[model samples]
Target: MTSALPDVARHEASDIALALDWVGMRGIAIPLVLGGPEAAPAAATAELAVDLPDPHAKGIHMSRLYRLLGAFAQHGKLSPGSLQRLLREMMESHTDCGSRAARIGLEFHLLQQRPALRTPGLAGWKSYPVSVQAMHRDGITQVELAVRIQYSSTCPCSAALSRQAVRNAFAEHFGDAPGITRGDALDWISGHASLATPHSQRSEAEIRIRLSPAADTLPLLAMIDCAEMALATPVQTAVKRADEQAFAQLNGANLMYVEDAARRLRQALEQHFGACSVAVSHHESLHPHDAVASCATPGWKRMG
Candidate 1:
């Protein structure tokens, strides 16, 4: 005859009598289908945990937590309501350990197809890193969403200095010539030896916001649109000569510093989200280090 399997976690008791702030799992791989305007499948890394208030209890049921997460993969589309429900269920499942709260985090890359700047039918896929975190405690649930965006930054100081250099070159070439025609000026300016281009670098923006408790869905695509529109120089994917020229024109027109980029993003995001924080980094081409700036609305405590 066979006996029942051994149960160590439920039967044993802990020697130590201290509680942990967070306890469970991290980097749990999961397949997720995010529900929004751009609903798509994402391979996500999940972190799940519950409090262990009962010092006497040996340990929490880790398998039960993993199983609960697996259930979500089977029949859930990630959203505020579903996240809240999952956290509540986690707390209920850990009642044996006297748990009062639970938290879940997911990280993934969201893919978007971007059209060429000037080409009508050409497009390519771009990926943005995204994360969503949620917690349930004391009859309240809070959710925070975050996304990372990449753009281009042309230094205003660099542009001004480059323009000065170009003017100096133009003066030397013309040398007070009489009756210089537009064609002659155009020929000189279009040549490679005429103008010095400003320094531009790839930059990144990390935006995190606290979703209103009453929000039903995640407005990720809309938020991304607002930020890209405000900044006006998102990095391109499919590029022909004409599209590249148009992109260069856009960069020349929207020259900005790190501070300018931060302010633009803040003003635009604040119009939509009440509690939002923005951090930007410009990987300077001229310098060894990156330029960075950050800002947040009032009463905005950053979520982990």
Candidate 2:
């Protein structure tokens, strides 16, 4: 025997006349597909949300949203079409509430195999912070991808000071020899390079891209490459003594401040994605707080 229960969501009316902008679940423990159609997808933790524009309805059909998300989770891929379908179903399911839009925020650590700087036989795993956010409204859908990549940031000021100290030391030691031999200079540099090495700290770049709806794939790996390649000193996974030396050399050549790092990432994103925003933070070792900078898709608000 089944007991009769009244469905309040359908039968009851809202006493309060205020309409809400967004009403739905968040941080739901559901898995999502990462990567694209061609690559093997990885699982992700997702937070889902939907908007309600009506003031008369008491609530919405939450289970339908969950079920739609579950169906997408079954696939090993996420594409523009799939995302649009989810958004459409969400609004249709809660048509009584007159829901107009939906949003999905995903957080996950993506893994990539990285080879040692010097050894071909040695390789290890590196994880990067990845997030994808999407919003659908007024027949317009916008998808944004954010990736965090860690690297080494060396101070140019420190490098200049180190060079001056080295020059002073050389003058004090061999000033009388009108000109020092290459061998002597090499000896001094080899011994002193570590003595006054420039300060470098672990840094990360958080990049976000607004994808075109016409785009099919997620382009996760390509987005990663843009940040890593611009920085040129990505944090190593498996490092040998030789690898350490190579990393030191890289830092020496690419010394940058937080602002410089932001500009570099911006240029890289502009060259690749055409329209995007970036907020890069260089966790400053010299200071107590992190150094941050933000860049956006030039004239995004004016654009349709």
Candidate 3:
């Protein structure tokens, strides 16, 4: 025997996020694929996120998102098309529930390679943290990409002070060498300058950019190279004695302040992404606080 029950029943619904703008899960770890240095694909761990609108909807079907992600993991290629498709699926999941908008965030560690300084072989596995965020509303989608690169920055002030100290020592010790040859003078200067103290700073550049829909490809590794060049010194993975010496010389040659680091990144972004907005932050070792700067697309307000 079957009991008579209505298919639909009236129930009270509560607005949980009346005062809040967004609420969701974060740092959810999952396996993902990213474009390799040579356009091949590599596996990485991805942190995923989704925004929930109505708190009283009981809870989001988290399993559905996971299954959708599995589909990408199984067969999707790591490219602009795949990324956009993932975003589209996430938005559709939310839109089916009568929500107006949805947001998804993914973070992964990408691998790259570097040629050995003294050897002919290539070394692998320089990991960089990358993030991608997608927001959808009313048939429009916006995607943002972020990458963090590790590099070295020598202190300009400290280098200048070291030079001054060396110059003073030379004037005091070698005042009698008036007829010294240029090479001999250089040797004398190097002997005295070797005693000066050099300050080395460990720094990181964090860059965020809005992607062009037409140029859907994500140039994360290229962007990383731009940041490394801007800072003038990037930490190396595989190093020989020569490489170490060269790296030391690089630090000595290109000393910079945190402001200089930010400006360098800004210039690089402007050169690479002409119409894209860029936000750069330099984490400095010499200071207690991080230095940050931002440059926007010329007509961001108009676009908004």
Candidate 4:
């Protein structure tokens, strides 16, 4: 039985956007399976984006992207290989629409274990939000990964001031008692000064790279570890008295301003990802501002 409705014509494009470089959706949410550093797969909420390179085109077929995501949701693992496949799928979808380039951004929360300082067996999961981005053009692909870690930083200037305050306090309290032990002087100093101001800065480490199609899928855990080590003090989940003391000692040893944090991350990324570009941002507490630093290799020059 034929219906009376007329057939709609298929939309076609000859010349799409000659003026615009990129156009697409952002903040699309989807479920994802992330693998690595776990006995089983971890479920994560992914914020995904795909670049559609034209305005003259009728519209992006958004359903295709969702279908690709669904295929991955069923059995896909989040590894370098899986990510490459996902990018290829996205590019293929866009190619059907005549796009010469494709880009994708995905954000997810990753979990890692935190070992107790003194207790060897006590450990728990800690969450770190991460992002991965990929771009394809003319058979070339580039990838970037980013992670956010929380850490404590003591202001060196503040630490020095606090030290002087303590010395003065000992002099005033003990009345020039030369017999006072160094430990006793430190105790008196801490009592007189703001011994520890919480310098909780949400820090970020981002690395972008141009990769060979055969390049190994990055070890996400390795990247996370490098960033944490660069920052020096990551917040812990299962902490005891010993852990707290260790954390305090770390803070004291690694006194950093926002600039120092960014530089350290940049150096660490350079050491770890030699062919990649790196950027670090430290959300500062002392001011209503953020401190950011970036370094890039020749391979990742386009990132700037």
Best by TM-score: 1
Candidate 2 weakest ten by summed lDDT: 32-41
Model 4 Cα shift for residue 71 (angstroms): 1.6
* Per-residue lDDT of model 1, residues 1-304, tens digit only: 2258778889998899878767899999999888877677789999999999888888999999999999997788888888988999999998888999999999999899999999899999999999899998888889998999999999999999988998899899999999999999888888944368789999999998887645668889998999999999999999999999999999999999999999999999999877789999999999999999999998888554
What alpha-carbon RMSD in Å does predicted model 2 have with respect to the real structure?
2.4
Candidate 1 error regions (>4 Å): 1-3, 192-194
* Position 298, candidate 3: lDDT: 61
Where model 3 places Cα greater than 4 Å from the true spot, the runs are 1-12, 15-20, 36-56, 122-124, 181-187, 214-216, 275-304
Error of 2 at 97 (Å): 0.9
Pick by TM-score: 3 or 4, better one = 3
Compared with the true structure, model 3 gives a TM-score of: 0.79
TM-score of model number 4: 0.77
Off by over 4 Å in 2: 1-3, 35-38, 177-180, 301-304
Highest-lDDT candidate:
1
Q: Note the residue pairs that clash in candidate 2.
A: none
What 10-residue stretch in candidate 4 is worst by lDDT?
1-10
lDDT of 3 by residue, 1-304 (tens): 2246532211334445432234345566566555444355544544333454554553444556677777877776555556667766865665533455555667777777776555557454688888777665566767777788877877788788888888888887778767768887788866676778656656666677777644536788777887787776887888878888888888887887767777777777778865444454546555777666666556653122
Q: Is candidate 1 or candidate 2 better by lDDT?
A: 1
Stretches of candidate 4 exceeding 4 Å from the true structure: 1-9, 12-25, 35-56, 93-96, 174-216, 275-304
lDDT of 2: 0.79
